[model samples]
Target: MSMRTYVTWAEMITGFARSGDSVSARRFFDQVPTELKNVVTWTVMVDGYCSNGQMEMAREVFEAMPRRNFFVWSSMICGYCKIGDVEEAKAIFDRIPVRNLVNWNSMIAGYAQNGFCQEALKAFGNMQAQGFEPDEFTVVSVLSACAQSGLLDVGKDIHNMLSHKRIKLNQIVLNALVDMYAKCGDLINARLIFEEMTERNSACWNAMISSMAVHGQCKEALELFCRMEKSNEKPDEITFLSVLSACAHGGLVDEGMEVFSKMQKKYGLEAGIKHYGCLVDLLGRAGRLREAYALVKSMPMKPNDMVWGAMLGACRIYMDMEITEQVAEDISTLNSSIQSGNNSHYVLLSNIYAASDRWEKAERTRIEMENEGFQKIPAHSAFMPCGA
Candidate 1:
């Protein structure tokens, strides 16, 4: 092939790498002889492996690169950070001879995305100290980290900082701020931000409604759904999911049914499994186990584990031994391994039988949990770290 042919092939190979197809990238890279295997070509291979989550392979490629540039080093840092290895990513970041804004932003985003909230906040602080003014990317990632780790004080501080910096409040930033406040149990301030936003999109409305739903303001969430319906922004299936979830939590059975009906009939939105699960939860909360079961049976798509789990939970709450047995048997048949491993179903079933003085059945359930090797999780758990 001529030099022009090599350039065209190089572009094609790099395109594969850029899109995370390392297998194909390597295959194409092998076609190039040693003489034409430029630094850019090798760096693309490194990026490809990194994007595909093969950090070791990325490292190998990086080491082999005769001339590594900023992009090559930064991609490795990002890969390490992407996989929750912040210490390694930071090591690479420290070695960058002359880091630019993109490099800084990548580090901040990496820490935040991997649940290293404090590290992300520290990076933001460090960036400002180095005389680099934060753009929208920096602020947004920090806001998300604050939201994830429930750093309410830190989140509030960031909000204040954004205001202090006179940053234009984009719709996404507003949504993130609203989500942070809601997650922090500060609905009053979340609502204030929502109401103050100049423009609202589907995502923004969904966030506000979801926040209200999660924070026990179910009625307010439904009201926001109504407001979304009336506005120019059309409520998608997710909007209905949020609304249905609100009704389920609040025990608005009638309202839940109406919304479920209208979502299909009026808005032309098809109910997904999550929507069905939420409706099941709504019915179950209202002490309508049979109705919930009928609805589950009526679903076009087979109800998933969550839908069955909801039914099992409901049967437990109502202390319906017969229904619990029936549902438990159904669940065991459909997803035996999953139901066996899940403590919620087993514990709830055992307690239901125990409440009715069926001590033998309850004991058997506990024994089953032991036999199935699901007693390892210790019955209750939280995924977050201490101090987040």
Candidate 2:
């Protein structure tokens, strides 16, 4: 290889950056002659750092760059957003002297991914106001925000806009539409869009099936899963998750067991903790507390709060003080390892202890809960029968 044909510094930097070896990427950047350094080189390094989650280092490189381009600025925004720092991403987005499609898309995605659905919708409106059209990515992100936030009208408008503009619906876009409608409690529209899709992916099927399951249409959800299996498209773990959830919700214990076996025996996918949690919940609901407890004890991995919580709920069902105490202890151990809503577990355990004639222990548990700044939430009940 002649020196004349040496790979350009830009190419080397980009390769290293993309490969996630920020250390090597930075070293290559350092060796480049200062005068030889261009915007591409700087952007590549910053992008590498950001992609590898070295946000602070990315900022350092970004600040030191003599000149910055749209990509560099946009990448920084994306990096902050990727790390769930939407506020900072938004601030940078606002400062861009000349915003482009990429910048707007990043901001919209950031807000949507971080659960700032209202902000995402507002950004979408702003993008349109600035004469920028929504591409598939933009459409998907906005649709997701709408789906999660229950902005059904906005989601429908987006669907209508695609039709009016004669935009082609790809698999991902179609999946998003289906998901949005389903999650917004518009299963009829979801089914309509799903039927219209010329092409479908597992996500599209899973979304519709999950929608059915969510709405207590487990039988129909199972039918869809069977249809998917009949086709060439293989069910992924997420697909099985929906299937199992449907079985659990419908109280189809035998079916849930069969599907659970198929997930590993036929599909060759290992059961994750989430699947076990669902199974335990199903058993708990079916009054199979002993089986649920045995399953939890036999788990290959450490049971999380959700799994123990399910068993605890089962103990509450059976009113087995000894087993309830054991599950309560596991939940207490999980409280230190997982950061989630453990108040229900604590309260249930306290109540169980009190009911089981363990008054002193119940008081101690209540005191521990108070030390953790939790109070017994007052139970309230009412019936509107109709929607409020």
Provide the TM-score for each candidate, comma-separated: 0.81, 0.88
**What shift in Å separates residue 125 of candidate 1 from its native position after superposition?**
4.0
- Candidate 1's residue-wise lDDT over 1-388, tens digit each? 5654556667877788778787888899778777778877777778888888899988887887788777887799889988889899998889888888788989999998888888899999999999898877888889889888878998898888887788878877888898888878888898898889888888888878887888899998998888888999999988998899999888889999999999999999888899999999999989999999988889998777788778877887787777788876876567654643556666666667767777778778778778767745333223112352
Give the C-alpha miss distance for residue 374 in model 1, angstroms.
2.9
Per-residue lDDT over 149-183 for candidate 2, one digit per residue giving the tens place of the 0 to 100 score: 88899999999999776766888889999999999
How does each model score on lDDT? 0.82, 0.84
Poorly placed runs, candidate 2 (over 4 Å): 1-7, 316-320, 333-344, 351-362, 370-388
Worst 10 residues of 2 by lDDT: 378-387
Task: Please tell me which predicted candidate would have the highest lDDT against the true structure.
Answer: 2
lDDT (Cα, 0-100) at 157 in candidate 1: 87
Quote the lDDT for 33 in model 2.
78
lDDT of 2 at 261: 93
Flag clash pairs in model 1. Answer: none
| Candidate 1, superposed: residue stretches over 4 Å from native | 1-10, 17-22, 33-36, 49-63, 73-101, 126-132, 166-168, 265-268, 339-343, 355-357, 375-388
